[model samples]
Target chain A: MMFFEGSEKKVEAVLKPGQASLRQLGRPFWAKMVAQANAEILSSIHNDDCDAYLLSESSLFVWDDRFLMLTCGTTTLVHAVTEFLQHVSQDALAMLTYQRKNEYQAQLQKSSFADDLASLAPHLSGNAWRLGHLDGHHNYIFHLDRPYCPEPNDATGELLMYHIKGEDADYLRSEGQNIEQIRQMMAWQQLLPQFQFDDFLFQPFGYSMNGICGDRYVTMHITPQEDSSYVSFESNLPSEQLTPVLNHLLKVLQPQSYDLISFNMACALSHATGVQAIDHAEQALPIGYQMAFQHFLLPSSQVRSADPL
Target chain B: MMFFEGSEKKVEAVLKPGQASLRQLGRPFWAKMVAQANAEILSSIHNDDCDAYLLSESSLFVWDDRFLMLTCGTTTLVHAVTEFLQHVSQDALAMLTYQRKNEYQAQLQKSSFADDLASLAPHLSGNAWRLGHLDGHHNYIFHLDRPYCPEPNDATGELLMYHIKGEDADYLRSEGQNIEQIRQMMAWQQLLPQFQFDDFLFQPFGYSMNGICGDRYVTMHITPQEDSSYVSFESNLPSEQLTPVLNHLLKVLQPQSYDLISFNMACALSHATGVQAIDHAEQALPIGYQMAFQHFLLPSSQVRSADPL
Candidate 1:
């Protein structure tokens, strides 16, 4: 259970460039907090003004005015939550979406704030849903509305999240064995040529890369360990490129089996938009993978309506 | 690509329960056709009113009033297409969904009707979408609306499909080296307690079972080969219990890598309904899978609308 423990904590914070330069303060600031979270620092890549730190178990990205972090394994990400609040105290926290799975075993209990959901519920102002399984791996999600520090009417932007986790920890690492080959393939594909890329290879276990495309960025992380191998791809660009990006990512990682989850801030009434994204990958994926599971996260208070004609 | 040549031809025909019983006209009818398609028949199992057949490449399921057949490999299902039209002429064909993937190779050209799409396109009425990759494996879907022969609207029910192929199929056969053990596990699970189960074991390569659960039926096929090993689980039951059914099926087949496709005639506007079905199996699936891809087929002309809060 200790080895099986993993979490993906993504915090979206608002920062202003003039106050604290991302290039000058971002990398060092996050590196210290990663250590504070009890996560081993493997490598950190800086591009434009954003710093992407690859931890032993997860990843973190710091931009000029925004912060996004995810950590897994026994890393006490909860401990760093207070630190993040302190560091970005001046900058507003726009949104916070924390997700965790594989939370069934006892050893992972303390590391997972999900274990204390009842207590944590009061502080977080957002919607939460559990896949509802006590004996097996389960998915838990918590989302906070825009303007983390509440304001009358602040609609910064809609944050969309898409994730796919390979079914087995060991299988994930094995799929990432050909990281160099994948990079070469991506280069051949000429994905996002406009961006300046900063890439890093972890000494023994993993690799990571972050591309800065103007103000937007796309980052990828792979932690190829036997006990807990994981790879994550994230971007804040328009949805137009989502299909190709995901297709290339799947080709590079090639997980044997995986589960897909999407949190769409924009409207996608009947999985219509999400389904299109998956369809694009189907053409590129090698035969033999089943999209065994998929989910579109929505607020519990929301009601379903018929698709538009 | 040569080894990747695969096709799943699923034909659905309407037969009346009182006439042309599957048990009476099924086995011999399909056995002869399997030979006609240039595929060898491994074995067949009949239970209650449904018949399940295992072939060198894919599978077949026949019910009292419906027939579902899928064939892969160099089976030349296109040749059998004429034969199927002939046999089901009396029963009347309800619907047909023929899907082919990895069909770019020259060797499979003659066996694939896809090669004659120019000529075939005019005959089929449904919309078609080709993943459109000529050099690599791609998904191509062809669907025809019900009443294969003009008849009144007949809503049989929603059909769900889930399948997985072993990564090193040869390895799966080696693991499945224990045939008797699999049978014992099935027995312990009581997968279909009320129905009489007739199981079949192929000479040296595969295994299949069909359970006739009253009016509903479940069938499974496994061809654990190195180059083209595959296992499929399909059922025509209510969605309420679909999750548990799939869990047990996955456990019995224990496929390392799998693909799932669901053709739901019923409503599942939000992936919310679909996610619930998959969440049921999450607790049971072993590690090492990435749910790599998924697509929800929609009415070709339908448009999207925002959700009602």
Candidate 2:
């Protein structure tokens, strides 16, 4: 739920009672209204104008401009949307958006997880177009079927992303920067590291050469996954070789080697635990890199700026 | 903060220990390590593999890596950005976002707020663009001077919002039906009643369109402000007033209203809130000759039905 108070202090004061607690039978009906004498003065919504930079997929619904989350399960679209509006008002920040897989028009033709168990097979060799739903609300939604993705996890598969809002997208369309300018300034090549997961094994997979929708924005286009054994390999990696390579890399790369913050965590997490530290951090830091340049193996005795190099 | 523990749960369980303030910080050496670790984590230096979506302003710094936020006396660009990231990450949603902003190259250009005010003699608007440097994490920031559009609080004299993120933004862009489709479907020539604030002296004078940004998603553009009056005059109505009129209409016309769960809330917030709820609702929704049917309103309430009229 997103609650838009003017200042941080006002936000804190107004959202003092704000929380997401699971209720008994129905949805979590956390109390939204917190009226107190000392409630921080906020910009009045009345007569105040709000302008939103929206793409085409954007639609605004009115439901008393409230911020609550109990509206997630409205069977009827109207009730559901009204409920979402209320939730949006409360905390647009932490909303766990959900929709029935079969309910969406786009998903109508798609087979169910059970019905398409054979279809749920992972891609082995080549690539596959991954059609994961627009991940979800700013909340914790759990337990979706394989139809969502061949992956095992729930709600946490955003390895590839696109730009949908802001000047970056607008500039890409309006200003029309040349390919050289794009390549040099933005370093578009380095943005996303190329890795072959079970979903896509194809090399040099370009994500939206042109903007995805009428030059409005960009998109991540992965090679399609045909019949394959994602299970044979651990997670997306082929367990036969990757496990050892990853383990070897972990053994060498140390934290505290760099002044840069994330690198320090890498060293710290590794030092704090062991090889497991690198594995543990994958959830928070999903992208990994080469141990030589991306990371350094610095033992404490000889741990210096030049030591890793 | 929103730790999405997928396969890396075991790793997360271990790395989570370092966050314990008391145990780690009790000793200076460990504290330094912890502080360093904290900084490292913030910097995003580790090129670990996970599905992370990041948004950036400047390509100079591939924040796919991380950086630090250190104050340089005055409120510089660096300070603003650090504060912005810190604010967004306060919630797990923002931290777990597939989207992020990058302005690592948006160097720390410090300008005193007092200095900005003291130069009021010239009343310069040329430097309005400089205000963009104030906040680093703002994905699509548009800063303006005060007094031009007042009453919405003058604290920062700026309005910044991050609208799209996660899959919501992706769907907004990648989908076939663009913004125009939704707009045409929703905004079916909504003719709204004359809107007012209190009496004839004060009323809404114009309609404004604002594009609010999230991560990759764009919400429909709509923002209408009420224009107040000090002197009496015989003024004609505004063609610009159409924005709000259409906004109120588009919201009330959503397909969710017809659904089983939403009819009530749909009927509630759909009616504009004013003194005497019953009278206002009555005027908005007539019994037999309902304004919904007689005037500018969508024919069908079902989003799937697609313009029944």
Candidate 3:
């Protein structure tokens, strides 16, 4: 099978005060905008604080005045962001951050981070920075330069795993895999029992899910082909909760290498036993958010033997 | 300074028996084809075995029956290859190989490897494979699947260094640098004393050189911005000579990480002290070439502290 670009394009926007609640924009409006990105809303879960969407490609989380949307594969996320900007007053945009993780097959993407930045420039003024090495694991981020303050709890953590192994990983690549089996394997209920989940298993392979627990939400997307397997786990849960959740996933997924990223908070991961940090970078963004990134790899002895190509 | 895609696009073609010698194609003909890629031929050097042209972007080498051309930056090398194929009789083609190393900024490229493959499909039948991880250092190769034996001495070695450090790297990035100083720093006379050299020092920063010794040739390209410094050393010299040249380069450049690739031969690099191999991959190409790739990184302690972003 051909390789898929599992690394996502992510856009998060926090609106100005006195602006209309994003919820009032309605599902129909959001779905139409998402369609611009070539993705569909598969399902969604809601709580008092957020509307979490499990999309055909990835996930979207909308709060009262802010939203986080992520899409994978070759989806043109820049189009959706452009559509959203056109539908809203430019004056109402208080802060906007667009992030793209380096992809396995970047050339296949419809737009590069540079293309996206140019498309957004007409709608909003911003500055961009690249974190980490361009030849290795890295992230590109563009954010509005205006003064703004984030909430104390406005923190995000992302755990991106690569080259997964073990029986659980095998099941993910196997034909008999299903949503329920994956749920049990992940043990999300035991780990985050309060969260409600909406998930989908793609035909042949791959899986995606959205989980909401009060204002905090978590999402996971998996592409489990033997050659280029990848899993991404993201959450807005408190920093303390990030460690256990990340540890559990690492234990289950058993990836050879992984990256931990935190926004507006310090990453709480004290490297797990066999894992070693390869590179670490921290930057205080001009837009008032503190970003930290660390890439980790398992010791050679701990890594599972890969099948010959 | 903005980052340039130092990684290169390479194309090699072997002609069928009874075909006219490529040298007979003349400089004007080859220059026209290189122009199709938006690159200019800056200078050239020749010996009994080959004609090596140093282009504004990279290098080109032509032998009687075969040619190897490489171009970097955003140049559309596929276009140049297409132009060359059109000039020659299709019936004269025996085998063709196209390769692309993963770039630091792939999204900036005019065409992806996949796009190049599609463009060449009508002119040549070939199979392709990716060596190494997509998220890190990797190479995409497309080759005609036909039986052809390479001479035992028909081998090539590439040493691609990233995040270069030390005084020489600093000189390369500084304004006071010159071509003669670079040549002395590289000590080509001591290393490959028999080879004749043609070199260029780009304004402000960077360097490129072509060295020819009889039938063998060596080329080096340097991009030395502090954040994204890279140096590429390639040669058709015997395998035994490869280790010393590569070792001398690593000692002088002191890159944080690097990749060593060998075609039709084994990579003879024994791990130097403090350096560790992160990954190694080997494959026998359908076109009768043995390809081996290894990625290595210096211990964290040995790496120079990078300037903060």
Q: Residue-wise lDDT of candidate 3 within B73-174, one digit each (tens)?
A: 888899998999898866788888888888766677888888898998998877888777655677778887777788778899999999898898888889
| Cα displacement (Å) at residue B219, model 3 | 1.0
Reference A-B contact fraction recovered by candidate 1: 0.00
| Two-chain complex of model 1, DockQ on C-alpha atoms against the true structure | 0.01
Considering only chain B, report the TM-score of each candidate against the true chain B: 0.61, 0.19, 0.95
Candidate 1: segments with Cα more than 4 A from true spot: A1-7, A15-26, A101-110, A116-126, A130-139, A145-179, A186-189, A202-204, A223-230, A251-256, A263-309, B1-309
Using DockQ as the measure, what is the rank order of every candidate, best first?
3, 1, 2
User: What docking class should model 1 receive?
Assistant: incorrect
Clashes of 3: 0
Compared with the real two-chain complex, what DockQ does model 3 have?
A: 0.31
Question: Chain A TM-score for each candidate, in the given order?
Answer: 0.61, 0.20, 0.95
By lDDT, the candidates rank as 3, 1, 2
Residue-level lDDT of model 3, residues A1-309, one tens digit each, is: 557768688999999999999988999999998899999999888889899988986888999999999988899898999999888877898899998888766677787888888898998888887776666787778888788888889999999999898999999999977789899999988989888999999988899989998888899999898788889999988878877888888888998788888888666564557666677767888677888777777644421221232
Predicted candidate 1 versus true structure: per-residue lDDT over B1-309, tens digit per residue = 013334455555455335555556746677887776687667666666667676665667776666666665556665555566566553354455555543312333344444434433445444344331111122445555443342322222212222232333333356345566656654524645566555666656566665566656665656554334455555565545454556654445443323344333232322311232211011100111111112222111222121111
Clashes (backbone N, CA, C under 3 Å), per candidate, total: 15, 73, 0
Of 1 and 2, which scores higher on DockQ? 1
Candidate 3 chain A least-lDDT 10 residues:
A300-309
